[model samples]
Target: MVGNNHIRSVKNVRVKGIACAVPAHVAEVTSLTDAFGAENLNKIRSSTGVERRHVVSSECSSDLCVAAAERLISDLNIDRSTIDTLIFVSQTHDFTLPATACILQERLNLPMHAAAFDIALGCSGYTYGLWVAGSLLSGGGSQRALLLVGDTISKIVSPADRSVAALFGDAGSATILEHDPSAPDMPFVMGTDGRGAKNLIVPSGGFRDRHGQSTETSEPGVRGPYDLYMNGAEIFAFTLARVPALVKALHEANTASGKEIDHYVFHQANRFMLEHLVKRMKLPPEKVVLDVKDVGNTSCASIPLALSLHQNKAGSHLSGRFMLAGFGVGYSWAGCIADFDNVWVSSLTVTSNSETEGEM
Candidate 1:
């Protein structure tokens, strides 16, 4: 007996498998204090729930993507040969010539038919990536897609910037997208604004300007350098406005189910940001799920990381209507809900502070 909400569209998709990877190098706020000077580190830790974050070990975004992908493959015992599509989303790629997906395809050893490519976006990349995979799976364009969100924002960050440098960390998260082929909520909404592009960007390196050598550098409407920059205040203000509106719009617009949603996962930008967003959305604290306090912010990887952790950490207790919201970097954003019926989502330990780090 499927409930009214559970009945869904004859087509709402279920999340099949999710895996997230953090670099082995873990740091405590104190350690950060030691690295960046205790006075400055103190100011950072006091506000954000994050006590520590993972920094990639001598690897670029591709390496981190593969780390998460391996876990997804292992967890599902998925045949590497059958992955029909691979979408690697990241703002940071190893080089200009090869797509990050190509590097991933070779490393993951997938079938050549697997359409591998990179969708370069920032934080919104996860939600946007979901639409790509879901549409392909549901339409039978492909049976499955390895949706990988990877970023090493730390590499390009200016340590002196202080705004995003201390707040973001490097990591990868992957999900195996298979079709419901039956009851998926195929409709999705995505939005972007180039007007806010300067608010968050790595200003250089692209074929558009002939790989950083172009007249654009001397011209107007151009960026400065190939380094990461974020206006934290602007991002926060924008997210606060847009996220709640999108969530409510999706909730009202949903025809798939009538059940009240169970969980809400946001982009995990920071503790305060999420807290404010949750309140503005008027969700009870329990319904809002997050654990990004420790891992800093993993840019495109945030939402999937939340999903991977909450899947297991929340256990059998977390089955029902749930919504996912991702925003940032493009000034782009997206929102969607999933009916996780008859599905078992795995979990992992994702405390902001591990045993030695003390309280959250």
Candidate 2:
């Protein structure tokens, strides 16, 4: 039997604002024709709908996230001391020894009494972060929380590897969650299937394989064991098998509450995959957000990044019932149905590599 697919709701928590940041260095698909060939590059662009991606040089995921957090705090005019909790969610953290969230607390100038930590998750991280932050506020202690999510996935992907090189970009996002007695419940459905872990993973670099040096011969354009390895077929199959059930559960919960989802924002894995999901689920294309053409797949940051970009392009604040889902990496998946009322979404900001150096 499938477990961990039930919907749980958190009450008395509301999102205040969201902001996203990307590196200033843009890498166009056309510039990669030399590595992937003209014909192959054209096919990639057509299938993935990715023309260009913002990349980072000498920048960590924390840098982008910090920039986004600063923008969000400034836009919202939030007092740093009022933020009682900080959660940094990302697979690409600044350092392995010290949790990036701890450093971020000091960098963002959050109060020392605030609870801070990190969640080392990838694609499903943003939803997971929201679930945790909302739950924290609902239980009564933290009045405000900062949910920072993003990934510099380009750092792990080999430039010559066509599988993911042209399909991923670097990005970070910050979301403010506050406790409000009048807010509606946020329902979430989350699950994990470890069986498909190896299908999308880096073979080494962790404690399991410290050096990341293996005797096995590497693929043509692939780097050593530290680089990302993705079995596209398995990932597609996993999504087809698992995500529909997740969405269905959320839909049922929303319907039971006498509401309907106004928008569906799934993780921006790729254009083809998203289009396939839209068709399979019989969802209205107009209500779905597909903004990955310029930014590519941003892993944990995709959902909020898409939301910010969509709202900016529309030149209006996003309000109403929304369904957000994130699946992939660790074979994990999560979906949330929430009611947002004129929430603040900042325009996408561009940060340079030098900004991350030294103190904030």
Task: Report the C-alpha lDDT of model 1 over 169-190, residue by residue, as the tens digit.
Answer: 7777777777655664733456
lDDT of 2: 0.90
Best by lDDT: 2
The alpha-carbon deviation from the true structure for residue 348 of candidate 2, after best TM-score superposition, in angstroms, is 1.0
TM-score of 2: 0.96
Question: Which ranges of candidate 1 are over 4 A from the true structure?
Answer: 1-12, 32-40, 207-224, 316-318, 342-360
Model 1 TM-score, all chains together: 0.84
lDDT of 2 by residue, 184-259 (tens): 9998999999998988888787887788775342475566688888889999999999888899888877776887
Per-model C-alpha lDDT, please?
Answer: 0.71, 0.90
